[model samples]
Target: MNDYNYVVIGSGPSVFRFLPGMQGSKQRILVVEANDFGGICPNAGCEPKIFFEGASKISLLSQKLTGRGMANPAKIN
Candidate 1:
C-alpha cells in the first residue's frame, strides 16, 4: 500500500512551491499532511484575522472619540 504516482494531499504554500516541479518527473510523490504546514493563510486565516480586525478598528475609533468629546474614554481592554 505504498504505491504512489502522485498524492499531494496539501501542506499549502502551493504544496511546497509546486513540489520542486515534481522532481525528476518519474512519479511517486506523496505529501499527505493533516495539519501545521503553512495552510489556511499561514495557519488560521490571515494573521489572526488581521489582528482582530485591528482591535475592532481601535475600539470603533475610541468609541467615536468618546462620543465626540474629542477623546477621553479609555477603558476598552
Candidate 2:
C-alpha cells in the first residue's frame, strides 16, 4: 500500500542518521533491510575478522620466537 513517505533500504548507520534529521516531521519512514540492520562490520566484517587474524598472528609469532631467547613461547589458548 502507498502509505509510507519514505522507504529506506539497508537499515545501517546511514539509515539511522537520516531518520534523526527528519525529527518531528511526519515522515512515516519505513526501513527495509535484507541483512542485519547494524550491517556487516560489527557482525562479520573486518572488525570481527581482525580478532581472528590477530590470534593467528600471535600464535605464529610465538612459534617463531620459541627456543631463541625466552623459555617456551606463549601458546595460543
Candidate 3:
C-alpha cells in the first residue's frame, strides 16, 4: 500500500500554483480529482467567457472601424 503525507483535492488554479513548490521534496503527495483538471476557470467557465467576450468586443470594433480608414480589421476565428 502507498501512504501519502499530503492529499490534495481538486486540481484548481491554486492547486497548480501550490503543487510546484512541493516538487523535489521527500514528502509523498497524492492529488484526487473527479473530473477534468484545472477546475472551472480554465475548463468551460470564466476563461472561455472572458475570451469570447474579448473576441466579441473586437469583432464589434472591427465592424465599426471597417469604413473609417482602417484596413484588414480583426477577425475572430
RMSD of each: 8.7, 8.2, 7.6
Q: For candidate 2, give the lDDT of residue 69.
A: 73
For candidate 3, lDDT tens digit of each residue in 1-77? 89999899998888888888887998888889898888877786786778899999988898889879778688887
TM-score of 1: 0.34
Question: On TM-score, who's better, 1 or 3?
Answer: 3
Better of 1 and 2 by lDDT: 1
Worst 10 residues of 2 by lDDT: 40-49
lDDT of candidate model 1 versus the reference: 0.78
Q: Against the hidden true structure, what lDDT does model 2 obtain? A: 0.77
Please give the range of 10 consecutive residues that has the lowest summed lDDT in model 3.
40-49
For candidate 1, write residues 38-71 as lDDT tens digits: 6888777688668877888877787788858755
lDDT of 2 at 48: 54
CA lDDT of 60 in candidate 2?
82
All models: lDDT? Answer: 0.78, 0.77, 0.85
Give all TM-scores, in the order shown.
0.34, 0.50, 0.54
Clashes of 1: 0
2 or 3, greater by TM-score: 3
Poorest 10 consecutive residues by lDDT, candidate 1: 67-76
lDDT of 2 by residue, 23-56 (tens): 9997798888788777776566666568878988
Off by over 4 Å in 1: 3-10, 18-20, 35-38, 48-77
